[model samples]
Target: MASPDGNHRHPETNGEAKPPAPKKQKLSTSITDSEIQSEFSHHDASVARINNGSFGSCPQSIISAQQRWQLRFLRQPDSFYFNDLKAGILESREFIRSLINADDVSEVSIVDNATTAAAVVLQQIAWGFTEGRFQKGDVAVMLHYAYGAVKKSMEAYVTRAGGRVVEVQLPFPVSSKEEIITEFRRALERGKENGQRIRLAVIDHVTSMPSVVIPVKELVKICREEDVDQVFVDAAHGIGCVDVDVKEIGADFYTSNLHKWFFSPPSVAFLYCRRSAKLSDLHHPVVSHEYGNGLAIESAWIGTRDYSAQLVVPSVLEFVNRFEGGIEGIKKRNHEQVVRMGEMLAKSWGTQLGCPPDMCSSMVMIGLPWCLGITSERDTLKLRVHLRDRFAVEVPIYYRAPKEGEVDPVTGYARISHQVYNKVEDYERFRDAINKLVGDKFTCASLSA
Candidate 1:
């Protein structure tokens, strides 16, 4: 059970997982029920608009239509005239395909969220690893910025399979694109030198902790040139956060939760495999009738559970086009807000922002004041309380631990996500709350006026 260096593993390797060591940080506001209700009010109102204004394809509606068609199914059961039912599904796929700029409908499959997508991809690797396709010396790489669940999974997998997980510790107070590129390259090069054939890698297009975007395209190119076989991207915070084009990133696979940024209903997410990769060779996370479909569309539609979430994708895409400036229009708006929040956080904390101002699209990680010395889990607990109890806000707090060259990648930091649903006042409350709690140990004051 020796984990290999540069190898990626899932967080739950043996179930005795370490709570994401979310170093101690400061929080000022509370996330009370009122706050949740407020946010939900806005979200729910948006949903109400959907039922009345327009309906692309909703579960309740789609099922009603299916029932009308399946009235025949009740009697025949064998050959129910399912022409309209199948047409609806096909139309939904086409709508999603256009929104993502995917190569074809064949490459897309809906899931619940980014985490599930990552799990499915991990299952593919695990299936291979257990079959002796990967051994002790092989390596995989992930970053401190990779979501906690994704990173933990990579670690668990690598360590359990006798492979090494090269956890790339990205530097904080990052100044420029070059700094980011340098950090990622260093990780890849270090893994290469450590006698680890970097087989797979995962990165977030837009990170949750520090809300920075990595140089994914460059990373993908480097991996392929270095002979890395696969790249899995977690876009939980990116789908509606940015205008994603799979053809542009060049990764073997990419996954995202449409519900987050796209404002889709609660559970619409998707996984995309490049046309080059054959799905028949890829294994589903849960072995189903369509496990080894080998590039077949059936795999994406497998299982018998409710597909309402998957079907809502088309309506969600339609909604985004209607209100928030549709794709490019909305993406530009998010970037603007993110920059405003980043600048404010930077000035107050007196620390350079996490990534270059323009480096990210919809998220930004700003340095904040916090306790002198704090641990990851303890820090996370505090922020969780502060945001929920005082601020009535919901956000992710993260800590990166040390590895080499850079200060312990583990630092007490917090990031604010500016989704379509967020407003300028929300960030103001966030900044004010920090000022009240951290006060001085927060540093970055010299940078502040």
Candidate 2:
């Protein structure tokens, strides 16, 4: 098995690092099919559960580990909170740091979720503007496909600080990577043209609604070239869903949710500040006793709350590593499954893929056929509820509005997420259910002009 440091090299036989041999499959009495099913027994068995992108399903092992931590806290509240919690928190941080290849573990702060992590950075930047560190006409750059909450956070803080939010409009059916980089450059130039300082640029590691994976490293390089002071990566779907190396990406700040892909419980995430990023005034939203005690410590103790989820980070990593050929194996399987399923559904429904396969992680966004009666956001939400309630299939249906002053109709996408517990049968059921629901009302020609 590969170590958490991501090193896969074996001993050299002839001046070349050899790869590890594949593990042989063996029948195990303990880990049975029923046991594997029991791992995800917490979910509704009847539901297709194709929405792991929204909230990942936690395994029995991780849940048990968190329960154990919660039990310890209940038994010895004082000792666990004061004596042992800090050490456990540090261990979790170290494990995550090694996983993401962060340079300094001290720079990684465990927050409630990715939104809170982003809030920390945006709030700090707002403070900088108030304290004269940033100029009056400073602007924050963001993409149109950014997570709605993070975009609102950036807009709120920037507007409050007398700064402008420069939104870079990206096409729904995205083109090449160079096109994205060019759009960002154009947005920055337009900001400068309007006398904006362009203080920060918030880019997504994996977009939420559109479900497209942006080339963050190249985007960061473009931000640097455009003289954007800080590059904050809203990597809400980053850590476990895709390959993420903070050191390699070289972003000023990166935040990801462990609950989404790390298989951890809800409200567990991390914020990584690069060592070279000069963010001195960053603090958590909740002002706890450790407010002035540095970033990690300040984020560690955010009032009296449930620390079981955060404390189980190491256990979650280990559990995922032990399950089905570990994290890399799981990711590979999910990517293959999602890509295959996406292609199959697109072909079956006579629709198109939202983005290229290479740009997809484990989530694939399939363009909805126009005949599905989804013309607005309200219709999309109604369809989502209908699928969940009537068909027992839980999936996300989002609508992307056309660009300003364009005659293009609104685009709809149904993003399907593939996890370890999911099989092809689940998506097949989804396809059949959609077909039955729409019948001959939807067809390939419905999308043709």
Candidate 3:
């Protein structure tokens, strides 16, 4: 019942792209990877639940920490009416900062999710400025890989400001690092015409759809050379999967959600504002306490709601270390799992990797063609449902539409996650399920080889 979005491939009964090759059918009753893929099952019946959700709701290490906080919610550790919640938030930010190797934790601000982080940064840029911050035609460039919601936000921002958004047409399964770096450079150059100096280049460190890890250092350099006003990295997927030190990347602004990959509670994210950036106008997503000085966002951090999720961040870091593997060990394990899954999925479905295996970060996006054999855009919903109903798997998919003569070499892709609880079998089952849904006889000879 899932429909394709405008950005993805249109429905076609026939085209050059082909369906996957069918595999022999077998019964599946277990949670093993093979069973999940080959068997026609469902996700709802597969596992325990939390927060009325699946992945984020799992009762894990971080939840234990939240329990401790809940036992004492009324009692603030500080001497005031509240306990030491402020101190707790600081500690959480510090924990995240240390892992990412950031120089100052002060630059980090807590939020509910990655989207909030994006809104905050955009708000600061859109409203935090004096009239001098921008001239009439100044442009901001966003990527096609950005989450759809973020794209919508940018659209509204530009339309209101008399500015424009130029989407960088990126290629998937890119062959070389040079190509990625070049694409970013070209994007900035494209935004520089009409006296618009590409005022801001809001890019994704690890794009959500394909989960491609960008070379931020080089891209930042390009933006600077292009006289782009700022570089904002929406690193929603990069936080836990890879090293995300804001100082190291030198992006003017950055945001990451702890809930997605970090396994931290939902509604928790952080923003990293470069020291010199003018953040005087973070007006609080919701007007809570008055933020007078330039420290509005940071000051507003204390506004409301139970700060339990943000407070639990430190515990999540500790838990990641508790794996006995430490942070490095956790990262390696996760990265390996994703890569392993990507290889198998490509083989089973006959589709090619959407991004380089190395570019993947414990999360992968593998391409899919239209049902009619035409290279199409991504149909994440259909993939999600098929994986669950037929394979008992639960994962996200992203679709991209073909652009005019630039027919997408590959369109639909399923973005896979390999978190701590995931096993090799989980990936195997995912591949099998894809074969079942897409029906095995498929090929992408031009790209796969």
Candidate 4:
């Protein structure tokens, strides 16, 4: 099969390389609001999408590229799937490697999403434990603020393998990086005292609920000093929001969702296995023909699923690069906008920011006053529905649980996401809507009292 670069080679047979294909002409960088909006077909113009963090919005151009690949798959089926797909996917892997500054393209694999990538790594670790590579009482360290689904996956794997999960309690409205590092060190030391081997530490580059950027590099350093065997950096919200250098962070495994920040279609993400980690035993959750072929091929063709999302990555990069200041510029604007919006909302709600400004990225968690009556999960859900239904504003309201066995009051945060499509007026509208709701609720409670 001919590669995307026009080099002809067969996976089953070795052959001479052909001349590279002509590169596609670059699109003009002059993009307007209307043009950009038009490119995002999935955007609901009627509703203010302040919740880009939930599921990323893709550009229409990238969607077009995905469609083109889908059409090719539909037309050729066998030839495209067997011959052409590998080259395109390899190219995409290289793009991902460059984006995150990975040491080599071989270290990267295109997975379904960050969640799937985490599952893959956990499964491999579980296998190792069962095969006696890891002991029964080994510890898998995690933070209390990890994405709920990921935490559950880690627990399932560790428990099934007779290993225990050690959760480092991280406070909400976290004050400083040192506080987190200190807590993690305590957990590591405690594990050591108990004669348990700390095998894997799943750290988030950017946490989900509280929306704070964890000091991953510092945490990695701590893990190394404490003799933690492996580190998995869950960077689901890291890539486009903040600067991510996997090579520098030096985690054993790194996974991030390109769909969330790179403006690609959903169900697309990348996983990086550092060469020194020697985790070549890792495979997709499902075994297929490409099983044991190697990480790149094993992850690339996982059960003949649609490769449109992976194939569209190049276009997504190109489209995002054409943004006003490129990826870094886009991140800068988003961070500034969210910080401003968070400050405004926090002031309007008469509450403090969830975390310091330095810890925030494109997403900000603005504390919702306790008086707002959104203390329970049901209450938070109702508030979310109210914001969407009454104000046409789509935003996530997170209810932070009190520490285990603690009697502290539950806190609420309106985690707002800022992207190029969002405007200052959108956040102002959200602020006004929330203020009215909280004010009315407080008045009613006062009357009842």
| Per-prediction TM-score | 0.73, 0.89, 0.78, 0.91
Across 1-449, the per-residue lDDT of candidate 1 in tens digits comes to: 11111112223212222222212222344334454344345343322111110111122322333344335335553342222223334444555666667877667766666777787777667656777877666777888678888877776665566667777777666666677677778888877885667878887887666667777888888788878878988877666667688888888888877666665555667788887634446545555654455322443445544444554444445444443346566678767877787788768756546677677776666655444233455666566455556656555555545446754233555666554445567777667766766654432222212
- Best-to-worst order by lDDT is 4, 2, 3, 1
For model 3, the local distance difference test gives 0.61
lDDT string, candidate 4, 57-147, tens digits:
8887777778888988899899887676776777677778888888677788999899999998899889878999888888888888899
On the 0 to 100 scale, the lDDT of residue 263 in model 4 is 91
Model 1 bad stretches (over 4 Å): 1-87, 194-196, 277-279, 294-302, 348-352, 370-376, 399-412, 438-449
Compare candidates 1 and 2 on lDDT and give the better one: 2
Tens digit per residue, CA lDDT, model 3, 355-446: 77778776777765444233433335544554565567777766665657754345667777776555567777766655654566433322
Candidate 1, run of 10 with poorest lDDT? 48-57
Best lDDT goes to which candidate?
Answer: 4
What C-alpha RMSD separates each model from the true structure? 13.4, 7.4, 14.2, 3.8
Once model 1 is optimally superposed onto the true structure by TM-score, how far is the C-alpha of residue 226 displaced, in angstroms? 1.2
- 236 in model 3: Cα distance from truth in Å? 0.4
Clashing pairs in 2: none
lDDT of 2 by residue, 118-194 (tens): 88989988987899977887888899888989878877887789787888888778757777888888888878986
In candidate 3 the C-alpha lDDT for residue 206 amounts to 80
